[model samples]
Target: MNAQFFGGPYDGLSLATAEVNRYGRVVSKRFKGQRVHFVLLPPLADWERVRAGEVDSAPKHPYELVKTGDNVAFHDADVNERFNEILRAPEEA
Candidate 1:
């Protein structure tokens, strides 16, 4: 699936699964009824670095993209707790 992102660092980007993983992971799948949330995070560089502890993959900005089907919405969220919660959440199987 491809989602269009607006606001934050990834603004104006329309990315696929592979491209999206470069910035952050899909923390939520159908989180709020057909909506997928992608947390905006710090530069990860690569998975090797992520496993090497060389990159901090934490939320860099209070921004995330919520995609519902083909439509995507960007939010500048202030709730850190929610970000952390979703960050640790497993994608729905």
Candidate 2:
């Protein structure tokens, strides 16, 4: 299957690609082909994956993408929390 880039609920955000590893790990997966981009997932997105057993990684791994952009790849503990602030509110609630 060809990977899809994520456009947030109202298209306020997007990702270059999503990669699911052979081990079942998932994130806003990146490839070298993408330039001047960012990979960020909703706070609930990773937790939902956890609930569904989609990711086989540690707790912080999901938000790893949010902590850094293309030029920097460092992990910051509060990345998820910070990202949640920018997500568009659901139209219904």
Candidate 3:
């Protein structure tokens, strides 16, 4: 799977490609050709904040693209059921 973050007046949009590897691993790769940019975080900072009761952000996986009237809302599910399914699938050898 390819995942990429797009920014501009339209930010926070991500593009991804999903594929199953010969070893049966579902892989996602960022669309590097799009040249999208994303914010980077310190690896351990999230864990520390979570333990400190300051991790109030939603999980960053399994997001849904919702369209309502003239507006679009991105919703992230608590658990990534779809992503899990892809990961668990057996790849073609």
Candidate 4:
């Protein structure tokens, strides 16, 4: 589930993956930021509930649940900005 940022300045913040559970459910997603990298684990039973639509509350972030594609992407305008910033920054030489 490794993903590369295909566009924007902070393209280096790429190669992310979702952690899976024993049942092959995605339990978390990880991404690297300019100053920090983060792992966002699904809330307790969040995957089951999201799939079932049993919970009334909507997910705060957009996520993709697809099965028929070579690549799937999830992005928002803010994410695009962040990525661009990360890519354009000067690197240590």
Best candidate, lDDT-wise? 1
Which residue pairs overlap in candidate 2's backbone? none
Worst 10-residue lDDT window for candidate 4 reads: 19-28
Clash count for each candidate, listed in order shown = 0, 0, 9, 6
lDDT of each: 0.56, 0.33, 0.33, 0.36
Cα distance off (Å), candidate 1, residue 79: 9.8
| Predicted structure 4: lDDT | 0.36
Worst 10 residues of 3 by lDDT: 17-26
Please give, for residues 2-81, the per-residue lDDT of candidate 2 as tens digits: 23323323133322233323322333322333312233333435645744667644533222332233432323224354
List, residue by residue over 1-93, the lDDT tens digit for candidate 1: 676656556567565655456656445554434555655555424434654667656646545666577775556443555566654566554
Write candidate 4's Cα lDDT for 1-93 as tens digits: 654332233233333355222212232322343242222223434646644666543333222222337764333323545434433556533
Candidate whose TM-score is highest: 1
Candidate 3 C-alpha lDDT tens digits along 1-93: 333323322235443322101111222422323221112222233434644566643323343334456553433322445444544555433
Between candidates 1 and 4, the one scoring higher on lDDT is: 1
Badly placed stretches (over 4 Å) of model 4 are 1-45, 62-70, 75-93
Return the TM-score for candidate 2, rounded to 2 decimals. Answer: 0.22
> What's the C-alpha lDDT at position 36 in model 4?
24
